[model samples]
Target: MEEELVQQSSSTWPPPPPFWQAFTPENIARIEKSRQQQAEREGVEDASNVRLHDLPRELRALQPPLEPADGEWRVFGDKYRLVDELPKLEDMQIRRLFPNPEDRDRDGKHFDRALILKRLAKSLLLNFLELMGLFAINPEAAQDKITDIRDMFINFHHLINEYRPHQARESLISMMQAQLDRTRAETNAIRDAKDKTERIMEGLGSLKFGDELVGDSTPQKDPWATQREVWASALADIS
Candidate 1:
């Protein structure tokens, strides 16, 4: 058999460079110089596009001072005045009282509720009046107007239900009753007109128009009978 030889590579290899080699002063200086150049370029670009007149006062005050700082003291010649700081006691007390931000928001909510109530009150009153046929010039047309008024009241009540204000509910109930009263009055007036018309027709039916050709055909018993009948009918209808 031929002689066999085994070759082994050495376990020790040359040590890697030191950690600080890559971060040498020369490399750090090169990086800083590049950063400064980039910053200067950006500054020049911004200055070219920016309008001095549009710049805020605070930003305009960012110019370098005429003299540099000497040790720890600043050598700027700007007018500097020392003003006493506001006392923190009141601020602390306020913060303690209103720990939650919602307290301020509650005031806003209350004002909004007041506004909503005012608007609802106005709308309810207007609707009530319209329903009662108070706008009708002729009292004879009051009966037909009652239905319209009733429907409007129903709609108003539904609207009030949605608002659901316990405090104002009583006031609304009183207003609704007033509307009912007005509607009742209108219905009575319509009945009175009908009764008057009926009385005139009745008196006419009893008289003979042709027989009175030579005499007075007009009935001369009581001049206020028709008026009295109208009043009685109106009272009965209202009751």
Candidate 2:
């Protein structure tokens, strides 16, 4: 009977059918419903995983109102007054530097006053420079060239001190000279290369016009161009 049952199970006609054969329309519908329910459960779980802080406030009153006027309010003794005066002083300085006749009435005639203040600032700065031994021949000569007090003070502190510890003044002069030298050298080199390229092109043009001269004779590339190609290949190999 067991042998007969095994033979029946093995028959191509089938006893009940394989597990895959059992997957009918109803079975497929049930599977789809289960998948949809699982997807909904996962979606709920994902929503729960999101942080509370990331959500928009349900109550608007929980968030603080913007306060732009807080910036305008003076905090701590005379700090705000000093901060307010800085813009007025800066305007005054700019007016003194670039004085306009038309805007005099609107902006106020503070040019002369600004100029006097600038001179006084310069004198005080020069006194400091003199104490630092920045000037050799004349301190007054150095004061005449100083336009921006902030820049002057910064250069005096950092550039002069750090770069030129012993001879700050001399180092400053040397730096300017070196910059000029480098500019001149670069300009001359560029000019020379331009002239050389023009000469090479003129020589190439003079060659007689024929297929023999210009054709398959491996178009004469510039020496610099050939060198650059060779250098590129070498770099590729190294890389």
Candidate 3:
């Protein structure tokens, strides 16, 4: 039986390596080095095949020039500060609260988030207005503009959603404050009602309506005395 098992193990298509040899540092290093080399070769090939012009205009702008600038570009030097110069939007200025990190460059250059939002807003409004005009002229032609308007609105909302956490926190604070105010108002109302009831009770206590009965000489008859006597007589008779 042992001989048969040995033959079966030896006849396996690919024998597993000895456990001690499999986990050796040298073997692991060799495997890792080969993988790194393969990755490098693939990266080089990918880089060589991709051209600058093939990239989108927005992506191309992110690429640095091959040559360094001759002079520093900071015209304002130490005088320049990273301050938000954009005009505040309605009540919640999310752009100011949570500015996009990618929008600002190391050179202190920053694209205006306010301007981007304004442009999107303007585009959405104008497109909707145009669609309305088109609908008035010809409803069939307006359908195409509606898609454009919808896309613009979606883009605008998508940008707004980026600062959703800040908006959500603000909304939560406002709601909590409203609830606290309402609770306080209700408490005050209850307190006022209690005070009013206490005052009414005090006023009723001082009235002279029942005072005259305290001093009256008239004796009131006990209605339940006769019923108790009858019950006692019936019990006697039963006994």
Candidate 4:
């Protein structure tokens, strides 16, 4: 009994108070205040994802500032040089399907962006022959994908004809940039959620793992070795 008392007394002096027991009115009030503040902050931040027309001009879109266009011409022109190279989008296919240049342009812009590429290539080829006289540059040698098309005419090239962006295209680009910004934001949110889950798992791991926990894991009572005979014997003894 004295040993027990000594052990109990030695355990801790003036035992630390419990961190939580039941919610008090003061605690509830503080929690409510914190929740309200968090909600307000979240509401303010959530507005960044939403575009409000009436908001200040600076606050309207959450995209990086687009650089002002220089008057120089830009062309997505590989589409011009590669049209003849494709077995599927052959000269026969283009002539049969879209005989008229106007029809070709309309269909390319409407149905598929590739047709637009074909039209641009033809225009560029004709313009080149008209200006520079015929050289043996085969359009077939040109190759690049949709994004690569952006850089196809970036450097000085006599074959490439530059295209100027119109007011409507600029507006469309602004909208596209906004959409890209939103997509990036959503991607970041998903990544943050994944990180949060990992952090929570790490926190749980920190609590569940320590020298004390490692020591506690040492096997004391185990049931794995007991078999059917042991159970039968135990039952018999009980009876």
Candidate 5:
């Protein structure tokens, strides 16, 4: 059995000398130098390849110039609702006080608080005038009884002085509210007519936008004013 055994050796049993060599400083320098030379030779051989600066004229011409990135912009809020409620002029009791707004004296009318008050009184006391006119018999005897009516008229004058502005302010607010409602309806109709992709924004500035009512602000026949003759007549009555 020993005589019959054969010896079989493998040639690839151990590594080569280069594989077993230590990384010395000089050897590393020499190896790096050889690698650089080899890389240069390869690059020269690969003529069709190009670096960034060496891009061909045609390729470079096709590429667009790089632009600076835009990372900021003006920003607006997506506010889309009314902030404050519209003035509720519908429930206000001002239209009953001064139905006419076109009456005004050409001279210093806005400053004439007394004249305005008196005119407002007369307009509000039409019923009393009719009553006084109806009971015009026995002028001297009825004067004492009619004195009550005069006193009542003076009381109404005081009431008008006290409450007329409040009424006017309310009327102004009411008219403004009506104007706002009309404008809102018009705006709504316009928006409805627009395409679906459009955006409608609200609540930017003041809640009461465009409050000018134009024609009706001081309309024809304003009841808060009187002719100077009306003042003379009232004064004569007082005397």
Candidate 6:
């Protein structure tokens, strides 16, 4: 059954890579070359793997800084360069950061703020690139760049902080406008209710009560008025 399944799969048009022209003369030659190169690399690595401690002191020693007079200490010592040596950034990367040339201009007042931010970004990238390699070669020099990076970050945040007052004012204005709209709606509702009440009172005034009950000649006192008078008499007795 497994043999039948294998046959069925292999019969498809365009077999998988491992089965497609795998045993061709060109493929076999390529595979042999790859294996030979891999073996050569392994042999080279094994030959080069020497124990550092076993080597003579002179072979494993760094030259005295003073003897070189301006070389060894500068390369591998506790010295820092006064000016930063920045790595070159590609033109494409720079264009992606600031596409418009006018944005790079610092003289214009309107573009000045953006110009500073772009320059800060450029400085950060340069320092980051230098620090990547400098940390392994010179940690102190790498740490020096960190201070500038931090200052630039702080300046960026300061620029952002300038928008706080504007944001707060906009929020307050939006809240007050919403409150005013609600108050106006409430006022309109109350005015509508007053108008409806006045209309109902005018309708009631137009009706003639005497015409509706003409057969009854005697006048009757209102029950609510009698009840009020009784209450007033009870209060007078209490007094």
lDDT of 4 by residue, 1-239 (tens): 99877886777453443533434565555444544565576675443343223433333232233333542332332223322232222332322222333464654554444454566576555554543332245434433232233222321121121222344587999999999999999999999999999999877765734334433556554445578669889999999
- Candidate 5 lDDT, 80-106, residue by residue in tens: 223322222224322233222244444
Q: Judge candidate 1 at residue 76 and give its lDDT.
A: 39
List residue ranges in candidate 6 displaced over 4 A.
1-108, 111-133, 136-138, 199-239
Cα error, residue 182 of model 6, in Å, equals: 3.2
- Candidate 2 residue 112 C-alpha distance from true site, Å: 41
Better lDDT candidate (1, 5)? 1
**lDDT per residue (tens digit) for residues 74-112 in model 6:** 533355444433212232132232224334455564545
TM-score per candidate: 0.21, 0.21, 0.32, 0.22, 0.24, 0.33
Q: Which pairs clash in model 2?
A: none
Per-prediction backbone clash count: 1, 0, 0, 1, 7, 0
Question: Which residues of candidate 3, in runs, are more than 4 Å off?
Answer: 1-100, 103-114, 123-157, 210-239
What residue pairs are clashing in model 1? 131-149
lDDT of each: 0.52, 0.54, 0.62, 0.48, 0.50, 0.60
Tens-place lDDT per residue, model 1, 102-165, is 4547656443444544655675576566646555666666665565445444444443443456
- Predicted candidate 3 versus true structure: per-residue lDDT over 1-239, tens digit per residue: 99877886778353553444455565555544544565576675443332243433334333344432442233323323244232233233223322445546756867565677898887877888888888788999987787677666655665666567778899999999999999999999999999999999877766655334433467866778999999999999999
**Comparing 2 and 3 by TM-score, which wins?**
3
Worst 10 residues of 4 by lDDT: 155-164
Ranked by lDDT, the better of candidates 4 and 6 is 6
Question: Candidate 5 — what's its lDDT?
Answer: 0.50
- Model 5: colliding residue pairs: 100-222, 100-223, 101-222, 102-220, 102-221, 102-222, 103-222
Query: What TM-score does candidate 2 get on C-alpha atoms?
Result: 0.21
